[model samples]
Target: MAPRPRFSSVPHHALAALRQRPAVATAVFATGLLAATAVVNRQLARKAERENPPMGRFIHVHGVRLHYVERGEGRPLVLLHGNGTMIQDLQSSNLIDLAAERFRVIAFDRPGFGHSARPRGRIWGPNEQADLFKEALDKMDIDRTVVLGHSWAASIAAAMALRHRASVEALVLASGYYFPTYRPDLAAPSIPAIPVLGDVISNTISPILARLMWPGLMRKLFGPKPVPEKFAAFPVEMALRPSQLHASAEEAAMMVPMAVAASKTYSEITVPTVILAGEDDRLIDVEQSVRLHRVIRNSRLRRIAGAGHMIQQTEAAILMAAIDEAASISAGGGSDPRDVMTTNG
Candidate 1:
């Protein structure tokens, strides 16, 4: 009773079995590698075009494919949308419809966000994305132009101005995010390597956490503080569609560091610039734009009341006014933000 059952002796064969488990070890290692590889591929597949603007063709640059719309023939005005949304969101925005009349409004899907392909193993932060745009413009023979960056695009615009100051004529940063401190609410999408186990889980299930706690995620980015019916007429649903999910996820992941890096260069910005923000912006703090306005020498800040993060979506008229104001102010024609610039008039 005290002795109980004696323990069985360790088997040499069991030790041998453990040593011979290379197949099992290889399988396990392969599983992890495969998981990582699939994720890498989805990130790589960013080059595939899912949503094409009914207007523009796809351009390939350094293994990346970008979707952009080139409308009008005057001075080039390149438009960049924020994270999660692409050129379509900007196209849906009045910012485009309003600005295209006077300037050549060219809007593009940043790599990993829109119809453009995603390049893996690298951060497509503002610097890289900005560099990509300069290359694209060079390819298009656009030596000088205006660049308007919205949301995260603002980071890219800042980078563009910093890197190639002379190439860009004027910079209009709307709801820009080149702040040093990241908001606490920012969430990163952990994209998986495959359809179900990887991207599916990331694109679908986990967002439920946000949808449940903060239903605002389900809404459109602009306000009256709720999702706009026109933008999110359908829900966020699934982000798997390449144009929506991967690009947005990468942008989200890259936000904080990119913003911090770009913030340092503001005071150095020499371009005639304008900082546009919503007084009630929920996505990024208004101070970000305000500070940017204060730091840049020639930059001015325009804050629209009762507007949310989607200033372009919510306060399009005001944003257009600001853009026209920037152009007028730079040209020494008008100091007022409301100066009209209609070619017909």
Candidate 2:
């Protein structure tokens, strides 16, 4: 009892000292908070992977491992997902099945997203990713097929067409950001891409923040239309993993710059292209697709009314029609304007 009374007094004395040295106390609190955050995030990532295991095959190309889903049987069609997501994004949208009906669909989990390896020490802009996928497709013996890119991946599709003009037979760009514009909101999420600070943030607070903001982000992405029930199959936890958070942040940081760099070569893309977008896309303006259609001379444009940025999920029927039109055009077949649905170009 006497010893306990002495220890109690010691704690009081230590508390008084810590209160006097506010800086030390603050540092201690910060350290504790970070430790807790790390523990929680680590557990969450493990749980996410456990619950949602990889459902596709893997290929090693140029020292990178890519996870991809291969389905259907016809001309090869490559599906490239947008920022922050994996192949499952397209799979959940039913786009894979729909396209697989007429084409051999191959949807890739782009570098750093999903189960793919995103090696550090090099920048992975749209062009770099395009080259990687080109090699991977070559290894898979895919020579030419229509390439569909949604959101950020649209840039990658364009880069692929420009770099290997003969490989991409056609292009279906949907809700893509093709030009640089003022995007102040990107500043916050991009913090996790900043070297040491980025590592710490991505491993801790970034995932937490992403989880909190996911609903609103989904709402915006599929706005003017409710987020489809099918999208529930998308593993939000997987996207919230620390690794994906870093990849997403990096993409966000490079979005504007990549757009500016890629925009210069848009005119050189001679592939048959079709641009699709929701008339009321809340995440990226529908005008982006309209403008891209205007730039690509051999492009068809379809602006779906009452749709949003996640047209892949909400407008899979319309998108499938677009893919069919693209494939037909790639084969030198012409589009029947009556079958063109809602063409503006």
Q: For residues 237-295, what per-residue lDDT tens digits would candidate 1 score against the true structure?
A: 32335335655666666677776667677788877787877777766887887677667
Clashing pairs for model 1 are 39-193, 46-117, 46-118, 47-117, 47-118, 112-247, 192-198, 220-227
lDDT agreement of model 2 with the native: 0.89
Clash number for each model: 8, 0
TM-score of each: 0.74, 0.93
Regions of candidate 2 where Cα sits further than 4 Å from its true position: 1-17, 333-345
For each candidate, what is the lDDT? 0.69, 0.89
Best by lDDT: 2
Best model number under TM-score: 2
In candidate 1, where is summed lDDT lowest over 10 consecutive residues? 336-345
CA shift of 263, model 2, Å: 1.0
